[model samples]
Structures are given as structure tokens and as C-alpha cells.
Target: MNENKTHDLEKERQYYTNQTKELLQNLKEINEQKELTESELREQVMARIGAEKQLQAAEKALEHLEMALKMTGAQMTELQEHIMPDVHKLREYFEQCAQEAQLEANRAGIMRQAIYARK
Candidate 1:
């Protein structure tokens, strides 16, 4: 009877050892799965941050373009105002020159007639 009790106790010890090994394996698998999930979450967060940075850059570019366009429009208006007086002055000078040329031509014609009459 003492030998049977010893054999039964040995069997119980072996069964407990097998159960502990299986539980450790299950725990290891859970830990690996958690690590993989954490890695994926980190990748997604980095991608979102990069996208946000790109959006900010695009917004800044748009603002710069808008300011440049406004400045160009104002400069165009100023140039138009600055050039109008010069255009009017140029037109008046051309008319005066045309009148002087016509008067010189008339005088030359009269001189030619007088020379022919004298001949």
C-alpha cells in the first residue's frame, strides 16, 4: 500500500507540471500578439502626423499665394494711375510737332513759287 500511494503522488506531480507548461505557452502567445498590436498602432499614429504636417504646409502655401495676388493687383492699379498723365502729355507733344511740320511745308511751297516767277 505504501508503494501505490507513492506511485499515485508521482502521477499527480507530472500532470501539474504539464498544465503549468501549457499555461506558460499560452501567456507567451498573448504577449507576442500584444506586441504586434502595439507596433501597428504606432505606425498608424506616425502616418497621421505626417499627413497633418503636409496639410499645414499646403495651407501656408495657399496663404502666400493669396497675399502675392493681392499685392500684384494693387501694383497694377498704381501703375495704371501713374502712366495715364504721361500718355496724355505724349499725345499733346505729337500734335504740336505735326503742326510745326505743316507750317514749314507751306513756307517752302511759297518760296519755290517766288523763285520760278523771278526766273
Candidate 2:
């Protein structure tokens, strides 16, 4: 009977040891999973920050492009305004030259008539 008692106690001890080992393995797996989750979270945060920076850069570039376009429009308006007076003066000069040529031609015709009448 004493030998049987020792045999039962040994079986109980083996069962407890197996339970402890399983619990330890479960705790280790939980810790490893937590670390992996933390690492993934860190990666996601870094990626978000990088995307935000790129978005800001794109916005800044758009602003510069808009400013440049506005400047080009303003320059075009200034050039048009600056050249209008020269265009008007050129038109007037051509008109004046046409009038003077007409007057000289009429005078030459009158002089020829007088010379031919005398002859």
C-alpha cells in the first residue's frame, strides 16, 4: 500500500509539471505577439508621417505654381498695356504719310498742266 501511494503521488507531480510548462509556453507566445503588434504599429506611424510630409510638399509646390501663373498673367497684362501706345502711334504715322503723298501728287499734276498750257 505504501508503494501504491508513492506511485500515485508521482503521477500527480508529472501532471502539474506538464501544466506549468504549457502555461509558460502560452505566456511566451503572448509576449512575442505583443512585440510584433508594437513593431507593426510603429511602422504604420512612420509611414503616415512620411505621407503627410509628401502631401505638404505637394501643396507647397502647387502654391508656387499658382504664384508663377499669376505672375505670368500680370506680365502679359503689363506688356499689352506698354505696347498699346506704340501701336497707336504707328497707325497715325502711316495715315499722315498717306495724306502727304496725296497732296504732293496733286501739286505735281497742277504744275504739269500749267507747263503744257504754255507750250
Candidate 3:
């Protein structure tokens, strides 16, 4: 009977050892899955940060372009104001030249008529 009890105790010990090994394996698998999940979360966070930075850069570029366009428009208006007086002066000069040319032609025609009558 003592030998039978000893044999039963040995079997119980073996069963407990096998259960411990199975539990350890299950814990290792759980830890591996957790590590993979953490890595994926980190990657997602990095991607979001990069995208936000790109959006901010685009916004800043657009602001600069708008400012430049406004400056160009203002310059065009100033140039037009400066050139208006020159355009008026040129028109006045052209009118004066036309009047002088007409007077010269009349004087030449009167001289020709006087010479022909004397002959």
C-alpha cells in the first residue's frame, strides 16, 4: 500500500509539471501578441505626425503665395498711376505736330499761286 501511494504521488507531480509548462507557453504567446500590437500603434502614431507636418507646411506656402499676389497687384496699380501723365504728354505733342504740318502746306500753296500770277 505504501508503494502504491508513492506511485500515485509521482503521477500527480508529473501532471502538475505538464500544466505549468502549458501555462508558461500560453503566457509567452500572449506577450508576443502584445509586443506586435505596440509596434503597430507606434507606426500609426508616426504616420499621423508626418501627415500633420506636411499639412502645416502646405498652409504656410499658401499664405506666402497669397501675400506675394497682393504685393504684385499693388505694384501694378502704382505703375499705372505713374504712367498716366506721360501718356497725356505724348498725345499733346502729336496734336501740336499735326497743326504745324498743316500750316506749312498752306504757306507753300500760296507761294506757288503768287509766282504763277506774276508770270
CA-only RMSD, every prediction: 38.9, 39.2, 39.4
Who wins the lDDT comparison? 2
Which parts of model 2 have CA positions greater than 4 angstroms off? Answer: 74-119
Give the per-residue lDDT digits (tens) of candidate 1, residues 1-119.
99999999999999999999999999898778666655665565566556556555655655565455456665577764665565556546545654654565455556555544544
Pairs that collide, model 3: none
lDDT winner between candidates 1 and 2:
2
lDDT of 2 by residue, 6-116 (tens): 999999999999999999999898778666655665565566556556555655655565455456676577765665565556546545654654565565556556544
lDDT of 3 by residue, 1-119 (tens): 99999999999999999999999999898778666655665565566456556555655655565455456665577764665455456546545654554565455456555544544
Rank order (by lDDT, best first):
2, 1, 3
TM-score of each: 0.53, 0.53, 0.53
TM-score of 1: 0.53
In model 2, the clashing pairs are none
lDDT of 2: 0.64
